[model samples]
Target: MIRYISLQNCPFDPGEELCKFRSESIGAIASFTGLVRSENEIVALSIEHHPVMTQKTLEQLCDMVITRYHLLGVSITHRYELLKLGEPIVFVAAASVHRKAAMEAIVYMMDRLKTDIPLWKKEIFADGTSRWIEQKQSDVDRSFSW
Candidate 1:
């Protein structure tokens, strides 16, 4: 199963869930969590998405990871709109027949989300200053070279 999730109202217990559904057919599972940090001088973050485009981009990302990594299952969750520091921002889980495939799938999904997704974030400072931050090209470039 695959889904785009919101962390605000969802508990991403992918590990526990995977354990319950484990089979001899599946040998590995990898999970990743991204949390909002307080280091950005921001009191809150707002993520914006262009409805249809975001969903299409995310699905294409998932499909690419699945095809590239030979994953049995892949799930990605990203939080949107105003979010406080320390909140869960993203969750990725992948199941595969080997550890390397699961791990690679998670990494690929994250890279795609950061580079291809149409989501943008605005940082709102405690002092009331708001700034829109573009996804840094350098960050995306680094992913491919690695």
Candidate 2:
């Protein structure tokens, strides 16, 4: 199985990354993209994480997904920095011989990432103020479904 995970300050193209996951045996690729929404008049979001710890945590998550779903390949890319409204924040793709496993892996990994990932985020409002974003109960509930 092929796996790639990266947390970088720069932006990434999900389509381009998915191209690398295509293989003869992999017939299905399930993907998800998380974007910064323009809610509450927020102008941007600033995300931070402990470099070493964040990478290790992400790798462990990918490993678990790959094992549970028997995926042929997976890629996860999350960005850190000040990102504007409508900007892409995270991209995940899982490939397998069939669609079911690929789809489930994508959802499982995203749900866990939303709650378990060690990342700090703050929303910058247009009024020149910001607040640290907290994990919501809804997100916890979603993870519980797994």
Candidate 3:
């Protein structure tokens, strides 16, 4: 089994990361890339985190998904610090022998990541106003579904 987790301040290439995550024995791979949206005239996103706790939480989440889905490989990458609109914020991928497991695992991982992680986000608008984002009930509901 292969498991990779990273929390960085720099931007990453999802395609390159996907290629690195590929395994010969894996028959299916499911991936997700989350980007900063241009909603509400948002100019940038500032992500903050407790470095140690954030990494630990992500690792634990990845391990749980790998075991629950019987995955052969898993990878998650998340970025902190300020990010411009439309920049990638996160990447998640799962590999398994069957397509269904991989797909479900990806969804589960993403849902968990949205709610379980220690990172916080602040949306900076074009008008020089910014606000810290709060977790949505919808995200909590989605994570609870699994």
Instruction: List lDDT for all candidates, in order.
Output: 0.74, 0.91, 0.92
Off by over 4 Å in 2: none
Using all chains and alpha carbons, the TM-scores for the candidates as numbered come to 0.83, 0.96, 0.96
**What tens digits encode model 2's per-residue C-alpha lDDT throughout 6-116?**
898887788888888857999999999999998878999999998888899999999999999999999999999889888789999999999999999999999999888
Clashing pairs in 2: none
List candidate 3 stretches off by more than 4 Å: none
Clash number by candidate, in order: 0, 0, 0
Question: How do the residues 51-85 of candidate 1 rate in per-residue lDDT, one tens digit apiece?
Answer: 78887777887787888887777777777777778
Q: What tens-digit string does per-residue lDDT give for candidate 3 at 9-71?
A: 998999988887656899999999999999878899999998789999999998899999999
How many pairs of residues in model 1 come into backbone collision? 0
Tell me the TM-score of model 1.
Answer: 0.83
Residue clash pairs of candidate 1: none
Error of 3 at 76 (Å): 0.3
